[model samples]
Target: MVVKNLIQHLAQLAALEISDSEVPKYQAQLTDIFEHMDQIKQLDLAAIAETFRTTEEENVLRDDIVTPSLSQAEALQNASLTHDGFFVVPSVMKDKDAT
Candidate 1:
């Protein structure tokens, strides 16, 4: 059974401020939850089998194949700004203390 004092203590532990009017509402909810848990505890499931997954679906992945890709020069050719051999982008960091 969920009592008013226990609910107040739980709220204090969780750093929550529950008003007097809300105490009865929370007390009823917590009691209902505990009653449902008690009903679950009385269930007989000794014949039930333990399984990890509910579905039989398997992952389908493709083979990792090395393919020819664009070169550095080709990649940087369309860039609006470029340094010696790399693309130059605007700085995004604002903190001076960032290393």
Candidate 2:
């Protein structure tokens, strides 16, 4: 696709407000990026192993052990709101009646 049309389509899909003066600049940038991606895709990697990460780091998570003990009343001691047997929280939806 022509850069102008591609930029217009992308701007519409992304809900972006790009001025006409900025189209050429964005077009150049996107063109360069796609060119680099194309170069990378053209590389022959048949002999290379698939890699998910570039670094040689290993997982560093601590061992998980079951050693926690807290009653429901104790857990809700500092809460500002509570119902019968659960915490009462304000509705996160935009409207309380929305479903």
The deviation in Å at residue 51 for candidate 2 is 1.9
CA lDDT of every candidate:
0.88, 0.85
Off by over 4 Å in 2: 53-59, 62-99
lDDT tens string, model 2, 1-99?
A: 237989989997876878999999989899889988999999999999999988888786778878879989998898899988689999774643457
Candidate with top lDDT is: 1
Q: Which parts of model 1 are misplaced by more than 4 Å?
A: 57-99
Per-model C-alpha RMSD: 9.2, 5.7
For candidate 1, what is the lDDT?
0.88
Q: Tens digits of per-residue lDDT for model 1 on 27-78? A: 9999999999999999998999888877876665678998999999999999
For model 1, state the Cα shift of residue 57 in Å. Answer: 4.2
* lDDT: worst 10-residue window of model 2: 90-99
Q: Against the true structure, what is each candidate's TM-score?
A: 0.53, 0.53
